[model samples]
Target: MQNFGLCLVIKQELKPIPLQNVVVEANIVDMIAEVTISQIYKNIEKDTIEALYKFPIYEAAAICEFEAEIGGQRKVKGIVKESKEAAKEYTEEVQKGHGAYLLESESKDIFQCSVGNITSGQTVVIKITYVTELNHDSESENIRFVLPTNIAPRYGSSEYSSSSNEGKILNPDVVSYSSKANYYLDLTVTCRMTSTIQNIESPSHKISTEMNIDENPKISKITLTEQITYLEKIFILVVKSKDLDQPRAFVEYNPETQTNCIISYNKKTFIYTALTSQEILTIQQVARVKSTNISTNTWINTLEAFRHDLQLPGKIEDIDTKEELECQLVLFFVSCKQQNGKDYSVQSIKTARFAIACHINLYSKIRPQDINNKNVYPDLYNAITGKIKILTKSGFGESRGADAFTESEIQLIVNHPAMQTDSPKGLLRRIFWHNAFEFALRGGEHYDLKIQHFVKRKDGGIDVIFYQSKCNQIRLSNSNPKSEIISISPNENIIKDYELYFTKRPPQCDDAFYLQSCNQAEVEFTGYWYKSAHVGRNSLNKFMNEIALVTGINCDDRKFSNHSGRKTFVQYSKSRGISDNDVMSVSRHKNPHSLSYYERPKTVLQQNTLTQINDIIYKKRVVTNEAKNQSTSFTAALEFYKGSISENCKFKALAYLNYHIAYYIIENNISPLPLSEKPRVPFQEIKDSQNIQLDEDCIKKFLQGNTFNNCNITFNMNQ
Candidate 1:
């Protein structure tokens, strides 16, 4: 009843306020921090063994099952149009790599010669009963051919293969076979071959870093009166000497251990002391003591005794008098408070005193050798050293700093490779952007942000703050709190050649077409763009185009849209892993998934690939002992092992079955020690069977809500 009355009284006193989304005029201070990044993409290569070994000069070549477009001189009636095109395309392709050359490039004659054909013969009558259109759902086309000739050709494995086989070329335009007239051979045969479209991509990236969040930002209540508990008023004779040649002098007021009490030499005696670890109290822990200083000394309590550790100290400079030493010992006490919510806290208090002079080391220059506080990680040195500090009194963790080039650079880069493109402005933005992004990306997915931003930092640079969102609705997916900012330049270095290459102008807009025109484009920070050499920032326009292309989002203007992709991508990626914060800092968010968004589709080719895999695996789920004699990647061992799955593959049963076989072989065989990674087949790779007809009664029954596993039967556990 008392609680009820109290709640009723509180309800009358509490008042609610409405929030107005007003356009408050406030400048957003940004602290720019920078890190230089150099990205170099290298191409990896794989070896291939061609099949001309079976077929001699007149030997039967490839047996393919792909479509052939027949574009003959005339309309070859029964032959399909694709068949004719395939014939012509094959002929042209075979003629490409048929000549014999010397093996050495330096040879007067031909150093190397091309002798075999990938496509050796053509049907007198083209009959491509099976034709397949190029599918954009997969990485490559699905098609296979036979190399029957037994002739061995010299193989040069290079990412760039200059030597082309003379057989039919299976290019994007056409799949064909080329055959020379065999005077003695006139056998009628159709190469019944198989093929498939396979995908090749790099693996996902993996990285980790030291943790940042800790209680060091909490407030302490230490007091000034409670400062040095043992203040001394020992009476002693005073003396001073101005001459550098003459030594300073002093005498101890009372008898004490000679070493601990004073330093006497050349008529000068010096006294030095600090609150011993036990003598000093933090207001919260004053009752915990077990030392002799607490009992014996009365007038001016002796300094507290603490732990013993030693370092060879740099000798104190020569002081002319005891007064000079007295001038150096002035001390101060500091403290703060936390309201309620938190259960624990840590501080970044100023812990040491030293005169600022050439001989004195500032916290900034205090080398690691001078530090004994190893509990703090190397990264927190600046924080502990007071080079940087936390100030949250006004609420949302704001920081400031003052020569601000580093801050500017950080901002410039942040806006890039995302907003600005690699262009000058974008480049600068990226340099700074990295710092803020790097900090946020580290928060991980479980983070719940309130407000995080970066503005002017102490270096006359940028400062960053991160917090949980205050928005009521889920406008954005980011939920992490505890963010950071920095100060620095955005670009690693300036690259002006891109601008000059396009002649000093942004491209002019085609008033009639509303499109920007760049006939002679130049590649700059913003990327490759060509505008009227006399007009605008061509690079900016190109950046816009790339942004739209890479992302489906449209920008209001080309420049605006072009530059915002990187920034916006941050939002999207933050939603993906939450823990991907660190990776995002490096601008490496879209790799493995990029393949999924851009894929090809062609069924026959896919079937051919499956067929090849099946053949390689033999009749068992696992590669049999027979398959072991094949090859390593395509090993007798791998016979049970089907090839790897695509990078962004979603899981399913067909893929499961294929990989299951491979798994069994590894589990039971002696080819290797570890199990192979199971394949992940993409449900996205499969085209929707929208056109399939269904019985009306059956459809009605299904629509009435029969139990089904999400309607993707291929995903059914049992094939």
Candidate 2:
């Protein structure tokens, strides 16, 4: 009875400030998904407090909506404003002691929320909504959705000079993951698609799925099996659909105008998406306007000519046999302003055609009609023995700028003992490495060449084939003839080295370059070739490092990879003051932008123009002093001195002029070098001038001024 009476006066305290709950709901469409997150923050402490929460989502997500509720009753919609204004408003509201909340972006994938002025026994709820595109892997046709949870503490300067959209990234709530509050998350997902769902799964979180229909699934729902306690890892889900392996087209028709259009291919092929409809119409309109001077047919012919001049890879053959279907396909592509949803240069198309022909024979179902009607334009004469062939060499990594080979480094490698004693392999390696450095050949291009691709010019030079790389094919054209190489070898016997390597060259294979054994009996070495460009690159780097160590050179700081050869060429050209355009010609870089990557930054002392400017400025400052305490200016004094000098002593006069300039530089503190602090002049040579007169007093007057206050200066004549 006493306890019951005491309960009548009990006070209601606030909750212990834990994140009471979290709810994540997602609605996924064909290529886009919209997500909403609800978080409940209850202040369990007896005193009023503010809560700060930092979280992460998908990088591409666009946050479009935010709202907050106080004490489960009062709700206010969030207004989007400029980052600074929003921050200011939030601060003002919080200071007034009104319950206020602010949500802001920290990075592409991260965000922060601050809720202020929660009274005792009060709870706050924050609701955030965002949308993001679902990533689809074209090669696999699998849809991936990732909800990031791991938000690493970003390291950067805390001070921001100005306010911008990125200003929110500097929020105080953006603390390190270790210091973040313990939070629980609950996730649910709903996805609908026109295509049949084959598999739905999560790689980062344990989840359960429910389908609307057991068979021929189209709609599905997924949920995490348990609430996540750690926001330190990601939640990933993948949805794979059936018929994804088959090439499919999406056709939408507008009944209002009876207009039908093909939008895309499995949302992966980008050919039609490369150009906008308006842009395509503009091109056609320009062509139409030009056709007024000629016939419409003539304009069409002109377009065909322009396309032909581009040296596009495929051929225009008799699609007339299946005329209607082919016409429709071509019109569809033209209207879409895309070929295969990708822009393929003339060269890549030929490569693709050649590749197709090479494998056409592998299929048993291939028919005469199929061969004749197939889109392989200019038919391959014979893939194996043809002049034009698609050669395949594999490599995956891009060239990362490593080290530039110095002239001394190249010479050291050229003279390594292994080049002479290690038989055919060593000799071959030496020649290959030298030529690669001089010519700046990319690893893949060099590895792909064959003997036929190299021509021994009559003028004791070599001509090698070069391909402007493309995705599908090695496109060939008469315009892309062999690049001529003038011999710039270190050794005088480079021609002899090349001749010897050719003599020891392994028996001919489809590939131009092959590895041969020093001993002819080694069958395994007879036709050894690199499987990929990466393998050859690694081998060359290893060989160079080994040689460098043997030569007592430090290779630790430098990365002597295959790209080093290219970088070395650029560096050498720059040192010789070669123009960027001229360097691009030898490097075959399509533009100056691509060439800039190879250009190294210049050192302060290497700036010759700046050095010249400094010399001129300091010389003028020294000359300025001559104008003071003298009847004539420095220029007038120089003129008088030059007139007094005899013809034979003219060289000495120039020396005297330079000496005075140096002396002035020392007096004015212009030169930092201690040796430059004094004037350099030969006094005996000046005295020996027979045509001129000079004495110790005259010399002293010229250098340090006369002792007399107002003496008219005169040269002492030799009488």
Per candidate, the number of residue pairs that clash is: 149, 12
lDDT of 1 at 683: 24
Q: Please, what are the lDDT tens digits per residue for candidate 2 over residues 624-658?
A: 32224232333444664558657556555545555
Instruction: Give TM-scores for every candidate, taking all chains together and pairing residue i with residue i.
Output: 0.15, 0.31
**Local distance difference test, each candidate:** 0.26, 0.54
Compared with the true structure, model 2 gives a TM-score of 0.31
List RMSD in Å for every model shown: 50.1, 34.8
Highest lDDT: give the candidate number: 2
**Model 2 segments more than 4 A misplaced:** 1-16, 149-185, 213-216, 226-233, 242-719
Candidate 1 lDDT by residue in tens digits, 595-644: 23212235645775575467557854464443343223222322322343
